[model samples]
Target: MTCKFILVTGFLGSGKTSLVKHMLSDWGESARVAVIQNEFAASGVDGKELKLANDQFELIEINNGSVFCVCLLGHFIHTLERLLDEYQPDYIVLEASGLADPINIVELLQADELSERLVLDQIITLVDAANIERSLAMLARTRHQIMIADVVLLNKQDCYPGDLTELSRLLRSMNPHAAIYPTEHGRICLSQLTESSHLAAGQYYGRQSADRPEQLSACVVRVHQRFTQENLNALLAELQHDCIRIKGFVQTPEDVTLSFHSVFENCQVAAVSSYSGAAELIAFSETLTSKQVRQIVRRYAS
Candidate 1:
């Protein structure tokens, strides 16, 4: 039997992980689900979060680049093919990296290897209502994400209580076929996603370029020594302006491992060791070079 594939896309901190966790919880252990999580950097935070929420589903991670990129496409195909052969799950949820440009999604499903085994079930994209305007202005890929989605979740609605008439109109104009739902904290009934026989148009609009734009870049650094929470916060504050998303695990001076999730102006730090001894912290920024990232680390990490 062909496995149903759900492609979930959204910009950084749009809550894609929360939605996947919701689906896993709703489905329960009886459902055989496999999740493919892609991250622009080798920070194992998201994968760890998924396992913590529900360990029943098989989890796979493709990091350091988007699965759509030519550099990582070969490895992604190999990993996925092996997973399909080894564990035949009922559904496969692909959580794309925020920077991922899924313009070639239709072409990907039609690939000789995956076409028969995996069916394009639905393309669900989450939009951060509060930051939608800023994200759209910052990146063209954000618009492309909505254009190809079968189901578009205008997530983080509580963050923006103002009238969404204009925003909704703009989104509908991008993809008239997509069903847009206003959601808080990315929570929504699974039935709403698949109420129709066809959720997505399965077509990408505007620029069909598969190339990941050069502006966005990710830098990964190992946090070898423990630092004070204040120091970490300072580093986050300094980076948050240029870096859109900064996350990973950091050790405290008192030997406590804390997970950090920093998006734009907000930074959430928790004393949770979700990952397995992975101390690499990653920061994604627009137009920030690797050297600059290292410099910032050196200044604060001292």
Candidate 2:
């Protein structure tokens, strides 16, 4: 029988490791499971965190880029084949890098030989409430990781004010169809993450060139003057670029500052509250980095 696989993703310090540890204990002897952890930076960091207590489940580590990219594609399939041949566990769980995106990871289970042995079970993307603003401003990769999630686990809710109204609006814009669950310290019920029986979309994905005129530029600037319907569409068209994400607040001339975020090619702008602040924006792309981001944000300072 083909094994079921779940891809868990989030930014660093999002409590993914803590969630996995609890899951292992919850399964107990009922379900035989295996773990595959892909670490972008340190190989052993996430693997060591999920220390297995017995032979009920086995854990494998894949350290490098990610399981979805071409460079590590061969390694990813090879490791799965080995796991199927050796353990043949009933289920598999993938702990993707904090910087990893789930769009490609889900595509893997839908394409090629690996699909034969492993079937996609669910995609759980953890969101860190405390560091989300900084992550959004600093890393485009982390934002994309959240865009393709099937079940978004909003971890670290205790750290911040439970501002679900704002979070819901942001998440809806990223995917519009994912189930969002807010949790404290990664304390989600095991059934919530593991019991979802939805299969992943088997479509393939690759980094493609941005199709807009501004996409061709090294740095495409997008300004959200307000949440006006016409202006929002114009802003999206102007900020086209390869691998870009947007976040921050927008201020209208009417003195309203709205929280805004964009994941992948999708952008969401809405009025949150009225403040004297001006509409602000921070963007990420191959050509945009931390230094450039600050400069860009300052340029649109309210």
Candidate 3:
């Protein structure tokens, strides 16, 4: 059977992960589903939290870069093809990195390589109701995410006690064609996850606005050597100023693999059994350059 593809896009802290988890729990019992979770950070925090039966669900974590970007588009295509050939899953869900532009992804799907094997099912964009106004004003990526969506989930309603009518009007103006649903913590009816005939049309691209300057950059570091805890701490300290999100796996001197995740001022490290020993870090500030990122990688990676 041809795999149905669902692309989930939203900005950081927008409850995309929570929505994916809910779908997995609710649907895993009945259908064979596969997931491709892409994150700007190298660590697989969201992938780890998605609980599904191994027999019926397959999860592929593409962390450290946006799959829609030039850096990882080839990798994304190869992995998607591999999943379809080997697993033959009933459905495939792509949880785009918070910084990803869903429009580029839709264009990629129209390419010959993926068009025949997989169908562009729907684009689900999750909007954080409480921060929508601020995000839309500050970030161009946020607007693009909303513009290409077939369904918009205006999530975090409980936290957003302010006027939603105005917010709804703003979202409607962005994509008058999209079906909007107001929800909290990304909770939505199970039917929304099911197949829909609303495949995104290719004509939308012609009318899209010109590309905007990218505010986010993903710098991936692959390390072969193990690091001491103190060494890792110092690296994170230096990155904290420029990076808003940091994640990936690190090997300690003792040969233990640990997952690393940092968002803003907060950081979390946990021991894990297996990892690629590669670090994918994302910096929000435009101040970060490729040269500086490579220097950091050269210092830490063996």
Candidate 4:
């Protein structure tokens, strides 16, 4: 049977992980579901979170860059091929890196190797209700994400302080064909997202150009020393400026490993297993220089 493929795309911290976890909890037991999580950071913090939520589905982590990029496309293709031959899952969820362009991903799905075996099921884009305007104005990729979506989820509605009428209007302007659903904390009716029939290759709007635009760069900092909760907080405070997103695993001074995720000013630290190797913190910032990021890491290292 052909694997049903769903591509989930959104801007950084738009709650893609939470939505994926919820979907897994709802549909995992009934269907053989597998997820391919892509991150710009080498460390797989999102993968760790998904495993903590549930270990039933096959989890594949592709990090260090967007899976659709030329640098990582080969690995992404190989992994998809392997999953088809070995896992034979009924459904496959590709949780794209927040910075990914869904247009390129759609193009990849139509590639000869995957076209026959995998079906382009749906493209679900999550919009952070509070930050949609800012993201749309600042990020070119954000527009592309909305344009290609089969379903546009206006997530984080509870915390959205602005007027929904305007946001909804903006979303409609971007994709008149997409079904827009308002959601809180990424919660949505599973049927609305997953029950759609397989979409033909041409159904998705927008095609990426042969030459892809440059993506936001990332800096990975590997820390060997344990950090106190206070110390971690201090580091996060410093990261809020110039950094679009932060994620990785860190060992606390208490000897417990904690998964770290930060987007804009919001931060979350969840307890995880004891990660033995050097704890890493991956930060994505458009304005911060690599040298500057390394300097920040060194400050915390001391």
Ranking by TM-score: 1, 4, 3, 2
Residues 1-302, candidate 3: write the lDDT tens digits: 67889888898768888788877777856878899998876555567556421335798999777787777778989999999999888889999878776676657876777888898778899998877776677678889888888888999888777888888899989887778889987888779645333534344654433233366665655556667776777777778778766665667778777666665555667777645334444444456775686577558543
Tens digit of per-residue lDDT, candidate 2, span 155-209: 7677676586687678667766577888886777776765553433332255421
Of the candidates numbered 2 and 4, which has the greater TM-score value?
4
Q: Clashing pairs in model 3?
A: 42-248, 43-247, 43-248
What's model 4's TM-score?
0.90
| Quality of model 4 by C-alpha lDDT | 0.81
Off by over 4 Å in 3: 51-56, 193-201, 206-213, 217-302
| Model 2 lDDT, residue 206, Cα | 54
Output the worst ten-in-a-row residue range by lDDT, candidate 3: 204-213
Greater-lDDT candidate between 1 and 3: 1
Please rank every candidate by lDDT, starting with the best. Answer: 1, 4, 3, 2
Best by lDDT: 1
* Per-residue error (Å), model 2, residue 70: 1.7
Task: Point out where model 1 deviates above 4 Å.
Answer: 197-200, 205-207, 273-275
lDDT agreement with native, every candidate = 0.83, 0.63, 0.73, 0.81
Which ranges in model 2 have alpha carbons more than 4 Å from their true place? Answer: 52-55, 194-302
Lowest summed lDDT window (length 10), candidate 4:
196-205
lDDT of 2 at 153: 82
Task: Give each model a TM-score.
Answer: 0.92, 0.64, 0.72, 0.90
Say which prediction, candidate 1 or candidate 4, comes out ahead on lDDT. Answer: 1
